[model samples]
Target chain A: MEVAYLGPIGSFSYRAVKLAFPDAKLTPVATLVDVIEAYEEGRVDLALVPIENSIEGPVNLTIDQLFHQSSAHVVAEIVLPIVQNLLVVDAKRAPEKIFSHPQALAQTREYLSEHFPQASSVPVASTALAAEIVQQHPTLAYAAVANLDAADFYGLVPLAKGIQDVAQNNTRFWVLGEKQPHIALPSTAQKVTLALTLPENLPGALHKAISTFAWRGIDMTKIESRPLKTVLGQYFFIIDLVSNDNIKYACKEMESLGITVRNLGKYCIYEGEK
Target chain B: MEVAYLGPIGSFSYRAVKLAFPDAKLTPVATLVDVIEAYEEGRVDLALVPIENSIEGPVNLTIDQLFHQSSAHVVAEIVLPIVQNLLVVDAKRAPEKIFSHPQALAQTREYLSEHFPQASSVPVASTALAAEIVQQHPTLAYAAVANLDAADFYGLVPLAKGIQDVAQNNTRFWVLGEKQPHIALPSTAQKVTLALTLPENLPGALHKAISTFAWRGIDMTKIESRPLKTVLGQYFFIIDLVSNDNIKYACKEMESLGITVRNLGKYCIYEGEK
Candidate 1:
């Protein structure tokens, strides 16, 4: 199957896709929107996009795009441990300029400030692009903050490993496909994600919506709010629940309360090596 | 009093600060972090930062910074009606490149794609800076998506107004001060924001936390989750509640459940003209 992912190749998303779909034909797309669009337009059978980071929280662009466009269902989850390494062409030289995706730069902010106090941190499109840029500019004292795969792919040396501020940094990626995976049988699926729209002008609307899961003794892994974009205060809540029989009932209860419930996915987690 | 805000003089934060604290001495900082740091260091009495937008949900940088570094309280909220106008140096020719901050570009994505599909969208630091750049390169067919104030400040003519995808585009700014505003009294405050950290390894921990509000009949205006940065699954929930006497009791109940609660602010909302 052909798969689309945000890449210049050797990105964290690339690593995730490679781990999850090892034999798939990988098509490197420039942006997150393009990845989803490729799948929606049937350019690829599936697409991989980073949905959340342990350090950076939700990937807003991915979530926003999913909310606004695309009818694709998440078929799989890939949890990859993120290690932001300092890569360079010459290890002995102190870099005067550092390049990275803004998220990586933020993750390594403390480390960068402590080590490369004088270096200017430039925000590029992606970590892989940062690696490519640093590799292309060998004459300049430029370093890149990227993953091991990026360093390997771009032939850059890892000047320092795990330069991120936190040791437990991990990113969760979603595999989006037009067709729901047959593996989503209740016996196999471990998680269920739903987008909930609460009825308007109702007092305690969100509270009542959460009550459906709470009273049913269901365990929710996450509940996040995104703007509905129609008004200032209205929102759409994206919820994740531990897969259980009660999820079906809870969704029904939510719908009974006039909350529009859209089942985004019921998927199993695939953890990549640390 | 002096105020620090993210700016190049005509940014949205600048406009928010100008509207909120009309006579204050304004210091334009380079980034959101700098705006907060300036206030924390006593260089400025207060700082104005964009916390949320109607179209773009929360401002991650501002929210993350507030959760991690600042001890400052949100003294007040300023809701400003955002109008993304297409500013041009010369309107006779079609633009080859369009410039705006990424958020603005995203807000105007549909509009841009429908109108200027041939033009490349360039992500700049801020919409005001985009306006300035377009003004500086007057000979080129360049357009900027920015506010009317920026166009006025940069002397660019408005090619189009309200080019955002949605008609109800509004941004909420927070005024952060080291000391709590005397106006925070229950009698005057309309909202209270709290950052809650749920106890570890507890089933339905989030639900139990929300129960504090549900049982007490309190109304919540917003609920958003941010990663605690320690692990992949752990999170910190930021909640906004309608100001009421029961807020104190709710905090006690949350603490009783072993949840760490930090009161970000109890303040009033100020709405800017549409």
Candidate 2:
């Protein structure tokens, strides 16, 4: 089995792919688009990308591509509590520049503002890139807000362990694959993901959109409004809720109510170590 | 009147601020947090920040700052259609670097990838800073993906106008202030935004959350689930829809349903131009 993820070498995404598919051959790609493109083109078996973060709401790029533009199925999900460390060359010296992914920078925002108020921050492609760049330029007093895995991979020492301001900073990664899982999931698996597009621009269309599920006493766990892309103010909703067979019924019911619905996947949420 | 906005100068936020309050004395701030902080601390009369984009779902920084972190009320909203241009030092040569705000960069990802595949894209603080830096570094072939206003302000020439992949890439800006408008708003100013917290972790809490408004035939324009920031999977919902005093009644009903609700604001949507 082959897995492609958004990476340089050792990103949080790399950590996610590793935890989920320990035995699969891993391939690091430049962008999230590249990961999905590779999968769509049949170059990879699965494409894994960050979908949401506890600190940052949702990875719009991944979500937009999945809902508005993709043919691949979100077959599985993995929630990893992001463990970020400050990797630096000179621990004693106050660094002038801090580098990391935007999400990493945001997670450690409070810590950075409080500790290194004067230091300038830069956004890189990934945390792995930050580590790689910081490692390559040893003369500059540059620190990377990245995972310990990245530090270990790049032979860098942790300046500060768990530097993220919020301890509960976790990112949920979605597995996009052409083929569905051959093995049956556990009965305890409950979450079902659906993307619904309205038939017309009716006044109460959105209110009615949720009514189908709500009337059935189904829980609406997460709801996101994304642009239809064709017109401004028009949106398609991406909803995640707990269900088993009721999910299929709800989708059919929504379709019957004149809404175009897509079952992105029916998978269990990751309940692993934090 | 005074207004605080994200700036170095000449960014899209700057454009929105100018469009909304053409005569207001604008005070450019360093960050969205700063703008909100300035407003909360009474340094400025109003704070203007991007709330949503047609391409990108929502401005997480502004939304997060306003909802979970601030006490200031979001009083008004202005929607401006983004007009981005390809700014260049030289039209003949392909630039090696493209600079812009992360939002600007993301919006022009398709155009950049296709036209300047080899040129590395750098994320700056704002579109204004990108234009400023690109202007100062004429020796280095640096181009900026910014608005036409920035190009004119920085004395940079536009390589291509309306270069955004999507033509209707509009952004909605929220006005944060201490006091709500004194005068009575027109009845057509019906969109009301609310932030609601569930009292307990229940199966149908979310379904119940929206039912208060949905059951009453109120149109749900937009519903977004944002992280409560206290817990990982826990969320506080932001709902916007067309309503009058019915929104207040719905809020009361939601409270009756044992949910903690915050009236973020009752403001009219920008309806100037498409």
| Candidate with maximal DockQ | 1
Using all chains and alpha carbons, the TM-scores for the candidates as numbered come to 0.87, 0.88
Clashing residue pairs in candidate 1 are none
- Name the TM-score of candidate 1: 0.87
Best by lDDT: 1
User: For model 2 chain A, where is the 10-residue window of minimal lDDT?
Assistant: A180-189
- Stretches off by above 4 angstroms in model 1 are A8-11, A53-58, A124-129, A152-155, A178-189, B53-58, B124-136, B152-155, B178-189, B201-203
lDDT of 2 at A5: 89
| Residue-level error in angstroms, candidate 1, position A220 | 1.1
Clashes of each: 0, 0
C-alpha lDDT of all candidate models, in order: 0.80, 0.75
Considering summed lDDT, which 10 consecutive residues are worst modelled in model 2 chain B? Answer: B181-190
Q: Return the top candidate by TM-score.
A: 2
Which portions of model 2 show Cα errors greater than 4 Å? A54-58, A101-103, A116-126, A180-189, A201-203, A271-273, B53-58, B100-106, B109-126, B180-189, B201-203, B271-274
